[model samples]
Target: MPQERPVEDLTEADAKAELDRLAKAIAAADQAYHQNDAPDITDAEYDALKRRNRAIESRFPELKRDDSPSDSVGAAPADGFGKIRHEIRMLSLGNAFDDSDVTDFDARIRRYLGLPGDAPLTYTAEPKIDGLSLSLRYEAGVLVYAATRGDGETGEDVTANARTIAQIPQKLTGAPAVLEVRGEVYMTHAAFADLNANGPRTFANPRNAAAGSLRQLDAEITRARPLSFFAYAWGVVSEPLAATQFEALERLASFGFSVNPLTRLCLSPADLLTHYRRIEGDRPDLGYDIDGVVYKVNDLALQARLGFRATTPRWAIAHKFPAETAWTRLEAIDIQVGRTGALSPVARLAPVNVGGVLVSNATLHNEDYIAGRDSQGEPIRGGRDIRVGDWVQVYRAGDVIPKIADVDLTRRPADSTPYVFETTCPQCGSAAVREPGDSTHRCTGGLICPAQAVEKLKHFVSRNAFDIDGLGAKQIEMFFADDVLSIREPADIFTLARRDSSNLGKLKNRDGFGERSATKLFAAIEERRTIPLARLLFGLGIRHLGEVAAADLARHFGSWDALISTVDRASPAAERAVAADSAELVERARAADEGRRAELKKTRDAIWDDPPLPDGARTAWDDLIGIEGVGSVLAVSLVTTLSQPGERRSINRLIAELTEIQPPEARATQSPVAGKTVVFTGTLTRMTRAEAKARAEALGAKVAGSVSAKTDILVAGEAAGSKATKAEALGITVMDEDAWLALIGG
Candidate 1:
C-alpha cells in the first residue's frame, strides 16, 4: 500500500477519503477481535487506526461517518451466546497515569465533596487485573447467570462457561437474594503457558486466553481451561453490603468468591502510592497479569454522594503505569467536523510502535495548535511549527488519545510546506467562521449541512436522549443514505414508519433488516413518542444544554408548552432589553445632562424589573436565569436555539407528532424544606456554602442566592448581613445554620 499522506498536506477531500478507509478497516478489526477470537492486527495497530479516525472526526466533526467506530464498544455479541441487559450499568473508570495524577485524583475527590484539607478520608486500593471483566448474578443463593461487561450495559450470557471455572462458586450461603458480583476472570501465567503448549490453538496473552475460554461455544472447552476468578465489586444488590469498600470486599470473600489477596486500605495519598509501588513490584510474582492499581473511596456514603459521569464513576479511578513513546513521521493533516459544527484538525502520522501499540495518528487540536501556539497564543513545542514529513515523537499514556510530544527537525523534508486551514465547510460549502475569542471554527450551514443533520439525528437517538433500542448510529446512517428513513430533524424520526407505510416494499425487506427486527425497531421508535421533557430537550442537541441543564429547565418550566411559550416571549424581550441597556450606556457617556441619562437608565432597568407574566406561568426569564447552576451564558444559548424560526417550527412540528411531553415529577413534600425557597446568608463554619446549598437542594429545597418577597426561609450563619434583614422585613422565616439544619433533620 502507498504511504499515507502527511497530515499537513491533506486537503478536505483527502481527509474524507482517508476517513472512509479508516472506518472500514477499524470495523473489520473489531469483528475479528470480538466475534472471531482472532485479530488481524496487534492491539497497538488497532488503537492507532481508532485514534486516527477520531482525530479526523474531531477536525471535521460534521464529516463524522455514521458507522464511526468511536461510538461503538466491543463488537456485537457472537452468534452463539445469548444477550443480557444489565440492571445497573457496568461503567469504566478514568485513568490516573503517575503519582501526581493519583494525588490530583484524591484532591479532586476532596474538592468535589467540599471537604477541608485536614478532613479524614480513606481509599481502597487493589491490583487492576489485566483480564476480562465478568459479572456473576446470584438469585436466592444460587448462581443464575454470568456475563462479560460487553459495552457496559449489555453483555453475552456465558453462564455455562462460568460454571466450568473452579474459582466461581455455584452457590453462595450468605449472599443477598439478588446480587451481581463483578470482577475479573483470568488465566494464571503458568496456566496460560500450559494451555498454549497443550491446546489446539495458540494464545496471545493471559487476558485473551481467559476471554477466549469463557466465550467458547462448548462448555467442555471452557472446563478444560484452568481459569480463575476474583471478585472486587458488586452490581445490583438487594441491600447494602457494608459501610465501606474495604469491608464490602471482605464480605464478598466470606461468601466463597475468590478475592484478590493484594487488596489494602489506604488512609492517605502517600499510603496509596506506597501500596501502588509495592503492588507494582509484586506484579510479576502474582501468577496473574495485572495492568495497574485501582483506587476507590472507602466510604459507601461518599461514593453515593460522588455519583457518576457519562461513562465512569466519580468515586473511583485507575492509576496506570507510565506510557511508552515512539518516534514517527508526520504523514499528513486532516480536518473533521462534529455535530455541533466544530472544525478540528488531526495529525496523520507514519505508523510506528509505541510501547506495545502502533502509533499512526495524534490530535492536532486546531489551527493555533498546529502553529505551535496554545489557546492563549503562547508558544509551545519550543515555538516550532509541526510540518509535514518531519519526524515527530508520539506518546500514549493510559488514555487512548495519543499526543505529539516533540519533533526531530533533522529529519524534516526540505520541500515540505506550512498547512493552510480551511475557511469553508467541506460538506455543504458553507462559510466556516471561527467566533472571536473562540478556538474552534464552526460551519454556518446549520441543519442544511448533511454532516450536521446526520449528527443531530444520531444524537436524538443517543443513550441519554430517545435511547431507541434498535435505532443506533449505524442504522440511522444506513437509513438516511438510502432515503428509507430521511431524518432531517428530530421530528422526522417519529414519522418514518408512517410516511413509508404506503410503499409496497417495506423496511423489513431491505438489506440488513429482517421482518422481526424491523417490526421491533418501529415499536422502539413508537414507544418514545411520549418522552420525558428533560430527555426531549436534551435530544434536541442544543449547545451547552447537557443532561443537567435539561433537567433544570424541565423542572423550572414544569411542561413543554410552558417552556416553549416562555422562550418565545422572553428571548425577544431580553434582546431588546440588552439593546436598551447598551443605548443607556452610550447616553450616559455622551449626554451633558446627568438627569436625562439617569432617567434613561432607570427606564431601561424598569422594563425588565417587574415581568408581566401571564397567570399560571410559574417561570419568567429572570427565574430561568436565576436557577442555581443555569448561568446567563447557558440561558443565552438556549434562547438563541429557540429564537431561530426554522428551529422553532421544527420543534413545534416534532411536538405535534408526539404524545404529551411529561414534566419531571415534583419534589417530595415529606421534608419540611421541600418545595420551599431558601436563602443562605453570611459565613458558614460547619460546611462550605456550596456544600450547604447542595445538602439543602438534596432535601428538595430551592436554594436561592438572594432573599426576595417570595423567599420561604432564610438560613443565617455567622455575620448575617442584609439578606437576613431583608428576609425578616418580608416576614420570611429566619433561622441560624444550626436551627436550619435541625429543621431539615440534618
Candidate 2:
C-alpha cells in the first residue's frame, strides 16, 4: 500500500489525479441518490468529498476538469419519466457543518456587501427538509406543469403525481399569473411506516419512499402513497412575489400552499443558532425527517446582491446536523488501553451502514456506559444494559468517529448476559482501578504495559505531534515489534541515521523502505529537530491534556523550564488535594451518622487549606490551575504523569534530541480582555457562544471551560447560575453582555 499524501503538499499532478478519482466517485453517488433514490453514502460523507474537490479546484483552478462535481447539482433526470427543461435553474445551497462554518458564512456575506461590523443582517431560518425537490409551474392561477429538480436545468415531469398531494394545490386562489413554486415532496414518518407495513416493498427511509412513490409510472400509485409537499421557494415568477422572504412565505401560505410553520425570521446568527437548537430538539416529535436547518437572506434585494456561486447560492447556507443513527448487532466488546494507561471499551459491531459510511466498531465510552449508567450513576438509554448478540444503535459522532448511542433490549438473545468489564489490564496483568470522580479505568502498570508504551510512541509521531512523513501507525507497530534495529522510543527516531552509519544494516534494504524513502524519512525527522512548544507539550500524551490546553500553557509560560518548575512546585499540593478528597470519600461512605460525615468534610477542608508543602506550593498550584482549560484534572495529569520515573526518563531523552523548542505565538493585542481568562455563563443574547469564543480568541483572551480560583473575569448573562456564584466568591470581575460590549469598545 502507498502512503497517503496530505492535500496541502500535493503537486499539480497529484491534484489532477485526486480530482479525476473524486469526480467518478461523486458521479456514482449522485446517480444512486438522485436517479435511484438510494444513497450509498451519508449526506455528510458526500458533502465532505465535494468540499475536498472544491478546495482542490480552488488551489489548482487550471487543473480543474470540466466535469468537476463543483459545477453540478443533482444527477440528470431518471429514465422512465419524461424530462422537463427547467426555465430557471433550481438552486442547491452551500453547507455549514458546524458553528464556526456558520460564523464564517455570516462574515463572508457582510464582507461581500461591504457592511459595517455592527450592521444588523436578518435571515429566514427553516428546516432543510430531507425530501425530493419539486418545481410546480402555475399559469393564470392553475397548475400547468410540475417537475423534479434534476441536474438543475432539467427535471422529471411529475405533473400528474403532483396533483394528488393536497398541500400542493391544483389551483392557487391569489397566485401570480406565471409562478413556479419550488418546494420539497416528502412522506411523513407515520406515512412511510404505514406504507412499508401495508405496501409491497419496504423503503430505505422516508425520503426514498417519498421519491419512489412520487416517481411511479402510475399516478394512482403516487396518490395512494400519502405524499405531501411544503412550498418554500420560487423558481420562475412573472411578477414580484414579495420584497422579503418572510412576507413571501406568508404570501405563499395565503395562496393555499402549505408552508413550514417552524420557519422564523432571525435578526442575527445568534437567533438562527437558537432556532436551529429549537428545531433539532423538536426533530424527534416532528412526525417527519429533517436532516438540518437552512438560513437564507431575508431581503430579496440583498439576496440578489449576494448572487450565486458556481453551483450553490452565496446568500443561503445549510447548517447540516451530522450523525444519522442506524441499528446493527453488537458482535462483541473489546477494551483498548490508551497512552496514559486509560482503559477504554470498544464495541465490535456487525457491519452496518450509518449515514452512508460502513461501521464495524464504535466507542463504548466506559463500563458504566455499557451498564446503562452515566458517570453520575444516572440511567441512560432507558436503563437497558448492553450485551453481546443485542442490537445497538450506532452514531457517527462529528460525522467521523462511531459511538454506541443505544441498545435494543427487545432484540437481545435469550441467552445473552451483561458484559463483564475487565478488572485487570488486558495487555499486561496489572490492576485497573477506576478512580473517584473519574469515569475511565486506568492501568497501574504505567510504561511496563506494552500497550501504554507503544500507544504513547504512536501519539508522539502523530500528525499533530512530530508528523514524520512515511512513518505511520503500521510502521510504528512493525518497528516496535522488530527483533533487529527496532525503534522503541521517540529518541530512537532522531538517532536512526547515526545508528545506521554504525555496524547496523542500512534501512534502504528494508521491505517497506527503499533508498529514496529512507532518505525522505530521515529528512522529515531532521526538519522537525526544532519542535514547536505546543506540539512538544501535546506529544507527551498526558491524560486529559489536549492541543488547545497545551497551546494555552505554552503561551502562558513561554519556555520549558518555567513550565517544569511550576508543575514541580504544584505537584505536592495537587497530590494532597487528590489524597484528601479520596480520604473524605472513604470516610463518608462508611459513616452512617450525618455528624460523622460532616466531620469528615471539615477534616478534608483542613487538609485542602493547609497541605504541608513548600511555601509557594499553594500559589504555584493556583497558577497552574488558573491557565484557562487547565483545571484541577489537567493540572494533576501534568504533574503526576510527568513526575513518574519512567515518563521522566523518556521525556528527558526526547528533550535532548531537540535542537530548540519554539515558543507559541502571543497575539500583540491591546484589548483589556487580552491574556485574561474569561468564562461566559447563562444565555448570551448579544452573540452565540461560538461567536463569543472566536471574538475572545481574536482579542487574545483565554476562554476557560468553567469557573476556578484563577478566573479573571466572568461574563454573566440572563439566569446566571453556579458559575456566577463561584466567580463572585473568587473575587473575579463579573459583567453582563452589554457591559462586556462597552468594556471592549465595540
Candidate 3:
C-alpha cells in the first residue's frame, strides 16, 4: 500500500515496480466491484488510485508496463451472462479531485482547440451517479438489448434483467434508428432499505445492491427490486443526436428515457465548479447515492475533436467529492528502496477505515513530505513534520494506501524526536546520495546493487520480452541466487544448459526443478534464440527505451547489427549534441549579460538543424533523429547505452547468443511505394505533415523528416527548401505535390 514516488524522483525500476503493483491492485479492485458487486474500496479511493497511476505514467512514459491498469476499463462481465460487444466503446471519465484540476481541464480543452484562454466555451455539469453503468441498445426505436459496461469494448448482456426496470423504455418514439442510450442503474436509499428489510438478502450500499439486483439471472428477482435508470449519455448512434450535449440529453428525454433533472449548462470553469458544489450540497437530499459530478464539453463536435485516451474521454471529467477521513496513530515510518534505489517513506498506521475501506498504511510520498515541506520547499501542515507515535488524520484520496493529511497538535507525543531520513541504503551498505535538484536519495550502486540487478534481469525476460514458457519470476529469482551454473544475464540464459553439463550442482536437481522441467526451461530459452529486433531492443533494458521507441528504432534500423552500427557511429556526435543542448541552459547560470546568453543558447539549440560533426556521425545522428518516432531522447538513450562500457559489453554478449533478429515487415507489402524512403519538404497544401507521414506509412513507405542520401523520393511542396535541392543533387526523385499525389494514384 505504498504511495507513488514523485515522477521526477522515479527511476526506471521504480516506475516498473509502481506500475506492476498498481496493475495487480487495480485489477483485483475492478473484479471485486464490477464482477462480484462487492467493492473493496470506495469510488473516490478507486478513482484516486487510477488518477495517481496515470500521473506516474505521464511522468515516466517510457516505463509504462504491459499490465498497466489504464489500458482497460471495468473487469470482464461476471459469469453466467452473455457477452455484448459495444460498436462504439463506453469509456470512463477522467477524475478531477480539486478545483485546480477543474480549471486545468478547461485550459487543456482550449489549448487543444487553439483558442484564447478566455474564449467562451460551454460544458454540461451533471451529478455522476454512484451505480452500475448500463448500455441500452435500441434498434429502429425498439429496445434490442441491454449490457453492462464490462470492459469498455464489450459487456454482459442483461437484456432480460434490464427489461424489469420501469424507467428503461422498451421502445423509443423519436430516437435514432440504432441508438444506444447509456445511463446509470441505481436504487434509491428508501428502495435499498426496503429491499434489505423485505428481500431475501441483506445489502451493503445502494450501488452494490443495485448492481447485484440488475445482474441477477432471474428476471423475477430484478423485477422485485426497485431500480431506477437515469439516461445521461449515449453510444453507437446511427444518426447524429444533436450539435451540443444539452440538446442530446433533451433528445434522450424526448424518447421516454429519464434524464437527470440536476443536469445544467455552464459557460466556464467557475460556472462548472459552482454547479459541482451545488450537486455536492444536493447529494444529501437526493433519493439515490451520488459520488461525484461529471462535467463534459457541451459541443458534441468539440467532444469528437477532443477525442479520448485509451480508456477515457478527453472532453469530460468526473469531479469526485472528498473521501471520508479518520484519525489513526502513526505506528512507524519505514523507508523502502525501489528497484531504481528510490527511497520511499511509507507510514505504518493503526488500522482505520476511510471511505468504507480498511486502511493500515499510507504513502508518505517522500522524505520531503515527511519533513513537512512540498517539492517546492514550501511549508505544509503548518511546517510540522510527521513523527512516529503521533496522532494523524488519514484520508483516502482514491489510492490503495491512504495518505496522512494532518497531525493532531494537541495529541502530540511528548517523547517524539525528529525522524532522520536515511542517508545510506538499508538493503545494501552503499551510500544513498541525494543529487542537487533531485527530490530522491538514490543508491549509486547501479548494477552492483542486488535490488536493481535482479529486477532488471526479471524484466528482461518478462512476458513482453523473451517470454520463456518454463521460466517465471519465481524461477528467475532462484536462478539469479544460484552461485554455480547461474543465469545472471539475458545471454547467460542461452548458455545455461551447456554450463549445467559441467556444474557439480546441476539445475535439474535444484528445488522446484526436475529433469523434465529443467530440460523444458532450456528448450524455452533456445526457442527465444530468434527474436524480433524490437523485442531484443526492449530486452536490452536501456533507460528511456520503451516498447514503442524500440519498435520505431527497429523498423527504422531493420537489424541488430544495423542498430549497433548506427548507435556506434552516432555516439561521439550525440555526446557533443547533448553537451551543446546542456550548454543552452547552463549558459543562463554563467556570464552576466542576458543578450549574450540568449545568443549563445540559440547556437546550441541550432545543433539539431545542422550539427557540426567530425565524421559520418553527422549523417548517422541526422538519420537517427529524423526517423519519425525515434526522437532525440530515445536516440540519446541508445547512444548513451553504447557509450557505457559495461552496458555495451552486456549487450554484446546478448547479441552473440541470439541466432536471428527478425526484420520488420512493411504494413502494405503490395503497395506501389512499399519499402521506399520518402521525404516531404516545405508547406504541404494537400495534407498535414502528420497525415502525409501516416499515408506514407500505410503504403509501407518510410517517411523521413529531413532529406538525405537515404531519401528515394522527395515530395516538394510550395517553395521547396534546401532539402529539395539536396535531393535533386543526390539524384533522388524530386516531385511536386501533384506528381507525388499521381504517383500513388491519390
Candidate 4:
C-alpha cells in the first residue's frame, strides 16, 4: 500500500500543488476506468485522490484553472471512434447559476447584436447528459473511426471499441459518401443495473459505467458493457447533413445511430422554458443522469456564424439544473447589475457548504421567482416570504449558485419582512417590464443602460457576429468603464476605429498586442466595412434574424441594393396591411408564388406518383430547391417565412447597409427521385445491407423515415417490421434492402 501523507505535514503551497496533480491523475484514471472500463488503480486509491483534490481546491481558490480536474464532469470521448478534426470546434458550455444567469446569457447575446428592445430570439433546449463524448466517422456509409473528445482540440483514438456497440452500425445505409457523427456515450439505469447484477462489484453511476466501457484497451472488453449512444451533435463531414439541429439528429438516426428521441425544437424562449420545466418535473423518471439543459441556436448556419469562445461556443449555453439542496438562513438580499443592465436578485445566506463549495448566496432568479407564494398564501418571505433572516433551503441544481427552494416559517426571524423584488434596472433605474404569461422581469433600458452596453459590445465583437480582432469581454468592459468606448448602440461599434488614438494605443500595449496589432485591428475593422450582405444582416443583430434566415433573405433578394430599396419602399404600406402582410409585402408574394411552384415541381418530379402536378411549379421548385439541403420541408418554410411582408422589409433594410453576395449553389447529380422520399428496411444480406442502400441513394431517391403513404417505395429485407407492415397497408410497394439495391441497378 502507498503511504498516505498527513495533511498537517505539508506546506500550503505544496498541498495545493499536490492536490492539482492528484486531480489530473485521478481524472486520467477515471477516463481509463469509466470510458475504457480499465482501471490502473484500486477504487480506494481513486477515492483518496479525489478527496485530496477537493480539499486542496477548496483551500486554494487561486490555484484553480478554468479547466481544472476538479471541474471534470464526464468521461473522455471514447477511443476507437473514428476521429476527425472539427470544422469548428464543438466546445463545451459554461454553467449558469440561476435564472439571472440564463437572463444574463440572453442579454449578452442581444447586446452583442445591438438589438433594440422587443427584439425576439429563440432557443432550443436539451438535457446535458453526464456522459462520455464520442466522435464516430463514416466513409461511403461505413463506420470507420471512433475517438474520445479530449481537450476539444484533441482526443484519444478509440475506433475499434466503438464498433462493439450495437446501436452504432458497422455500416450505414442511405448516407452520403462521407460523414462524421458525434454523440454522447451513456448507460441507462436499467442497463447499468443489469451489468452490475451478476458482477462481484456494482457500478456507482452511469457516467462511471460508460467511462469504464469506452476506455477499454481491447475492443472486445468494450463489447460487454451495456453502453448506448445518443447523438446530439456532429464533428465534421464532407457533405451537409441537415439544415437545422433537430433535422440533423433525425438524419443521424436515419443513418442507424441512436439519437435521443426526446429532443424537441421550440419556436420561442418561453416554449423552451416550458420544456425545461417539464424535464425538471420528469428528471427522476429519466434513466440517465443529466446535470443541465443545453440551449443552442437551431440553424446550422447560425451556429457556424456564432462560432466559439475560449472554452465554449457562443451559439450554445447550458442552463444547469440544481444538483442538490441545502438549508440556511437568509442574511440579506442584494441586487446586482448585469452586463445587460438587468437587475438580478441575489439572496445572501449564512455561509453554508453545498456540493463541497462554500456558498454564501443563492439566486432569486427574477421578481416572479421571489414573489411567488406557497399554497398557504402566507407572504412567502419579507413581503414575498423569502425575507431577511428567514430560514431557507438552498439547492445547487447543476447551477453555479443555489436557489431558495423552501422556507421554514417556524425558524423565520422576527425581523424578516415579505421580500419585495424590484421592477426597475438597479443600475440605470429604468422601468422593467414583465409581460403576461412570462416568468421573468426584463429591464426595458435598451442601449442607454450602462450595464448592457459593455455586454452588447462584447457580443457584437463576438466570433460569430462581426468577429472583431483583439477584443473580448474583459476588454469591452474595460473600455466601457473607462469611457474609451461609448458604445451605447450597435452602430457605435462601427466608429470604434476612429475613436481617440490614446485609448487604441493603450490597448495595443496590453499583454497580447502592440502597435502592429492595433494597426492590424483597425485594418480588419475597415475590411469588415464592406461585409457581404448576409454577414452585415447577421451583424445588425436584428431580432429573429439569424445567419441562415439572413442568407435566405439575401438569396431571395439577390443584391443588397435591391433588398434595401424594396424595404424602404414597402414600410409605409406595411402598417395598414397588417392582416395580409404576406400578400401586401413583395417578398411574401414572391415566396408564396415560389412555394406554389415548389409544390408543382414535387408532383412532376414524382416518377412513382400518378399525374404530374404542373410545369410552373417545377420551375419555381427548381429555383428554390437548388440550395444544399433545402428539402421539401425547409423549402416550404423558407417560402412561408418570405410570404410575410414585414420580414422581407426588415431583411431589405438590413441589406441597404451592407454588400453581400450569395455563394454559388451546390450542384446535385441527377439521381433518381432527385426530390422524392424513399424508405428501406429489414435485414439486407447482399453485398452487405449498407452497400445496397448507398448504391440506391446514389441513383437518386430521397431516403426517409418509416414507410408512409407519401413514400415512393419501401425497400425490405427478410422479416421487416412496422415499416414493411405500414407500407403494405398504405399500398406502397416494398423491396428488400437487397432487391431495392437491385432496382437501383447495384
Candidate 5:
C-alpha cells in the first residue's frame, strides 16, 4: 500500500495550494448549506475540513488567503427578495469552538485597541437564528422597501411582499427620513405547519419556509406565509441612532418594527452564559428555530476597534447549539488535571461525528459520573458509563464541544468490560483525592503538578490579574513547562524578567514570539514593577477583594505605608467609631480636654453627645467616613483584609515599591443642574428621547418620570403629546426632543 501523506510535513507552497483548493470547496459548501438549505456534506465533515484548513493556515500564515473558506457567512439571503444597498454594511460574526478561541479573540481585540490588559471590554449576547435575512427600509417615516440579503452588499428587492407583514408598520410611529434596518425573517415550527396546511407547498425547515414566503413574486403570497422578524443589524442611516446594539434594538421597536423582545444585555462572559442558558431553556418553547446565540462586545467604541475579519466581525462571535447526536465506541478513560489540581475524567472515544467537529473524546466530569451506571454496568442518567469498547452517544450542543450523552448497550462489543477509575494522577503520579462536597477529584501533588503549575501561571498573567504584556495563557503554559517560569507564588512573575534569555531554547523557537518577544516581555515586567497600589492589591488574588475594594483601600490609606499602619492599628473600637459617630467616645476623652476643646472634637466627629478626641484622630475619622459609596460593611472588609499578618507583610513590600506613587481620591462634583429638575415631552428634533434622558443625567439634572409643577423645562417637539398638555396645566415648560437637545446644547 502507498504511504499516506502527513499534513504536518506539507511545505508552505503545498499548504497554500491545498488551502486555496479547500477554500473554494468550503465556500461552495457554505452557499449550499446556508443559501440552498440542502447541505452537500454533514455538519461534522464540514467542520473537520474547516478546522483542518485553519490549522494549516495557522502553521503557515502565507498560506492564508484573504477570502479563505474559513470566512463564509452562516446565513444565506432568501431568493425573490429585491436587493437594497445598506448605508453602512451589516456584517456577520466569527465563531469560537472552545475557551482558547475566546481568549485569542479577547487578546487580539485588546492588542488592536492599544489598551492595557486590565482595560475593560464589555460584551452583549443575542441568539443566532437559522433563518432568512431581510432589510427593511423606511423613508420619511413610511415603509418604503424590504429586501433579502442576496450578497451582503446587495439584496433582492421584496418591498410589496414586506408591506403585507402585519408586524411591520406601513407608517412608523415616528420614523427618520431614511432608515434601513436588517434582521432575520423566520417561521415558527407551529407557524410553518399552519402555512403548509393553508398554502400551496409544505416547507422542509423553518429556514426554507421563511425563504419561500419572503421570495414570493406576488406581495400577497409573501404576506400569506407566517413569518416573523428579529432585527439583528442595520443597513444605512442618515442619523446616529443608538450607541449600543441593545439601544439600537429598542429604537427599532419604537419605530414600529416588531423586534424580538428576548434580546438582552450582558456585562460579562459569565453573564453571557446566563443568557445562553436562558435560550437553551426556552428553545423548545420558542416558536422559531435558533441555531445558537450571538455575542458582541457591548461598547461601540470597542467594537470599532476590534473591527472585522474578511467575512466576520472580530467583536462578535456565535455560540452554536448542537442539533444532532450519535453513538460512538468508548475506547478508554483518561484523566486530565486542571490548574487547581482538579482531576477531570476524559472519555477516549473512537472518532465520531458530532455537530461539525470530529469527536474523539468527551469529559466525564468526576467519579460519580463514571460510576453512575445502569443494571448492565453501562453509564446511566443520559451519560455513557466508562466501558472499554462500549458504544456511547456523543452529542453536540449549539456548536459547543461534544460530550458523551448516552450509552447504547445493544451495540456494546462482547470484549468490552466495565472501566476502572484511576487512583493516581496521570502526569505527576500523585494520589487522586475526591473531597466530600466536590464532584471533581484532585491530585495531591500541589505545586509539583504540571497541570497545576501551568494553570496557575496562566491565571497569573490573565487579563484580570497582572496582565503582563506578551504573556498569553498558551505562552505561560509553554514557559512553565520549559522551566522558564514558575508558579510557586505571585512574586515568581517578577523574577521572570531576570531569566537568561540566551539559554531559553523554547523562547527562541516559539511560533508568535522569539528572542525579541522575550526581551519585550522582560521590559513589560519591569514596567509593571511600580504598579498602582490598587492594581498591586488586586493582583495578590485576595479573596473577595475586587478592584472596587482595592481602590477604596488605596484612597482611604493614601499610601501603602498608611494602609499597613491603619491595618495594624485597626481594632474593634476603631471599626465601631468608623461605623457610627458614637456618643461614648465624647465623655471618656473629655477628661483630657483643654480650653473646652471637647466641644470642637465633638463637632469634628459629629459627636456632640460623645466625648472629645485629639485633632489627628478626628481628622482620620472624618476622612474615613466622608468617602462616597463606602459604608460599614465595605469599610470593615477593607480594614480586616489589609490587617492580616500575611496580608500586611505582602502589602508592606508593595508599599515600599509604591512609595512615590499616589492616586487621587475621587469626589462628587457639584451637579450643573443640581437645583433644577427637568421633564421631557413629545418628540425631539435633535435627538431621541433616550438620548435626551442621558444628556440630562450628564448635566447633573434629575429627569423626572412624568411632568409635574416642579418641572423646570419641558422640550416638546412636533406633534406634542398629552404630556405637553399636562405640563402646560401644571405650569411646566414643554419642549420637544430636538428643542430639549438644543436647550442642553447637545
Candidate 6:
C-alpha cells in the first residue's frame, strides 16, 4: 500500500515505511509458496511485489534494511524433508520477452566476452519446462542423493521420492566420478489429468500438480502420482562430460537419463529463434508444459569465460513466450517526476490477471503516447486517446515492464473527459516546458524543485560519484527534509558536519542514528575532501558527462584547476560556434539554390575548425572536444553547466571547501605502449573494437578515434579507410591487426 505513493512523492519516512511493509509481505509470500506449497497470491502478484521492492531499493539503497528481501532467495527448507546444502549454488536464469531482448542478450554476451560481432559463437537451445527444479547427486557412478532447488543454496532431500521416478538413473555406467545432475521433475498433461481425476483433490495446472506431488511428505504418495525427470544441466562434476553444452546433454541421455528431445544446437540468434518457434509450434502436442526456451553458450570454455552475475549465469537466458493479456479498467493517471526532472505518466488500473500475474499499474511513456501519437508524431490507435474509466488491455511478457496494449472504446465511460497534461511542476509549482525535438516536458525549476533537488543530491553521493560511505539516498532525503542537513547543492554536503557542529540539533541523537554512526558519517564525508578530479566532475551531476567522459576530461586536463580554467575560457567560443552552426542550418533550410545550400552545409562543418575567439580560448575549445570520445554534444553540456552563474558559484564554493583533486597517475614506462596515442580503425577480426581499445589502454596507451599528427600508431584492420590513409600520409606507423597483436604479444 505504501508503494501506491508516487516515487517522486516518497519522502525518507515514506520509503522506510514502504520497505518494511514490502519485506514482511514478500517474506510471508515466500514462506507460503516454498514451505506450505499453497500460495496465497498468484505468481504474477508475487513477481510484481518483488519488482516493486527492487525498484524502491534501487532508488534508496542506503535505506535497505537488515532484512532486505533482495538478498534472499527462496524460503527456508520445510520441516519434513532432510536439508541438503548444495556445493554449488543453483542460480536462476534471467528472462527475455521478445526478439529484440534475445538479440540484446547475445550482444551483451559478446560484449562481456570481448568477441567481435562476426566472431563464430554457438548456443544450445532447449525447451524450458514448467516444473519444480530437482538436483540428483552421483558419486563413483552410483546415485548418492536427490534434492529440490530450495533457495538456490540449500534444498530438501527427496532421494526416496526421486528413486521411484523411472527417468532418474539409480546407477551410471559412463559419467563423471562426482556429478550432480540438475533438471526438472515434471508431469505430463495426461498424467496430471489422470492423477487429478482418480485422486480426491484437483489441480490448478501441470506445474503445480508436479510440484505438489514431488514435495509430498510421503514417498509413496509422490510415487503414486506419475512423476518424470529430464536431466538438462549439472551442478558439481569432477570433469566436464563434453566440450559443448549440446554434447553434454546428449551424453546425459547416453548415460540412461531422459533428456528433452527438442534440445538442439544454434549457431546464431536466427537459429535460436527458429528453434524457439519450432518448439512453440509443437508445444500443444508435446504432452508436457513448457513456458519458454532456454539458450546457453554452447562452448564450455566460452561459458567459463563468461562467468556468473549475482543471481544468474551470464552465459544463459530464457526467452519466454508472450504473456496472456486481460482487460482492466483505467482508474487514474498519475504524473511522476524522475531524477532528471522529466515527467512520466503512470496508469493505475483495476487488478486483472495477465499470464498468471495480477497487473495493476503500467507505464504510459509520455503525453504523446497517452494521446495516441507515436514518437515520430504518427497517429496510433486511430488517434484514440486513453481516458480514465476506459477498459484497457494489459500485458506482461517475461521481464518486460507491464504496459497497456490497447483500449476498448465500447467500454469507455460516457462521463470521462480528455486528460490534460500539467504545465507546472506538480511538486514545486515551477514552469514545465518541452524543448525543441524532445518528446517529454521537463521542469525548469532545476535545483529549486523538490523532486529535482532530492534526485540531484542522491546522484551527488551515488556509487560512482562522491560515494560517501554513510550518506545514502534515504539519509539524504531525511536530512534534507528535517533541515538538519540542508544540502541544496553538492557543496552543502561538504559543509554539513561544520554546520551541524554549531547547531543545537545534532545528528547523533536522531532516531536512526546514534553517536557512533553519526561520527562515522562525518568521517566518511571528511575523507572524501581529497577526491579524484574525475569523481568530483562526475559528482556535479552535469547532464551528458558520465563516468567515462569525466575520466576522459580529467586525463586530458590533468588537474582540477586546469580543467576548470580551460572550460571557463572555452565556454564563450563553444557557444559562438554552436550559434554559427545553428545559423548556417537555418540558412541552408532557406536557401533557394542547391549550390548555396551545399555551401551553407560546408560552412556549418567548418565552424568548429576555426571558431571566432581569442587564440587561447580557441585552443581550449579545440582541446576540450578533441578527447577520444568527447564530442560537440558533451562539450556543450560541460560549457553550459559551467557557464551558469549560480551553478558555477556553487561549484566554486564546493571547490574552495575541499582539497584540490589529484590527477590520475602517469602510466608506467614499462608498459609496451606507454604514453603512446594509438588509433584503431576498421573491422577487427580477432576481437571487438571495444576490447582492442581496452587492451591498448591497459598497456598505458591512449586510444583515440581519429588519426592526427599526435597519433603514434594506427592499428588498421580489414577495410581500413580514411584514418589509415591519413596515418600513412602523416608518416605515422601503420600496422595490420595481426602485426599490432604481435607487437603487443597477444
* Top of the candidates by TM-score: 3
Off by over 4 Å in 5: 1-18, 33-61, 74-87, 328-746
Query: Model 3 misses residue 317 by how many Å?
Result: 0.8
Model 3 RMSD in angstroms: 5.4
- TM per prediction: 0.76, 0.55, 0.81, 0.43, 0.44, 0.67
Q: What lDDT tens digits, residue by residue, belong to model 5 across residues 1-746?
A: 00101244344323433443454456666677656656666554555456556666556542334345555444346554445665555555555555456566666666555555777667767777877777788788777778666545566677887777776677876656788888888888988888778877766677777876777778778766767877777767777678877787788888777777777887656667778879978988887888678778777765654555455676787765545788888888777766556666677888976655577877565566666643344555655455777777876542223556667778878777666677788889999886654454678997678766665555445444456787766666566655444534455556555545554455456667788886787778777776666656545544334444455556545576676554445444355465344444454466465666656555545532255444344344334433322444444555665666765675454444432454533332375454355766654545445545545655656555455454677667777788688878888766555455555554
Cα displacement (Å) at residue 579, model 5: 73
Cα error, candidate 3, residue 572 (Å): 3.1
Number of clashes in model 6?
1
> How accurate locally is residue 713 in candidate 1, as Cα lDDT from 0 to 100?
90
Prediction RMSDs, each to the true structure: 7.2, 14.7, 5.4, 19.1, 18.5, 8.6
Ten consecutive residues with minimal summed lDDT in candidate 5?
1-10
Give the Cα error of residue 402 in candidate 1, in Å.
3.5
- How many collisions per candidate? 20, 3, 2, 66, 36, 1
lDDT of 1 by residue, 335-368 (tens): 7776777676778888888776666778776778
lDDT of candidate 5? Answer: 0.61
Best model per lDDT: 3
Better of 5 and 6 by lDDT: 6
Which candidate order results from sorting by TM-score in descending order? 3, 1, 6, 2, 5, 4
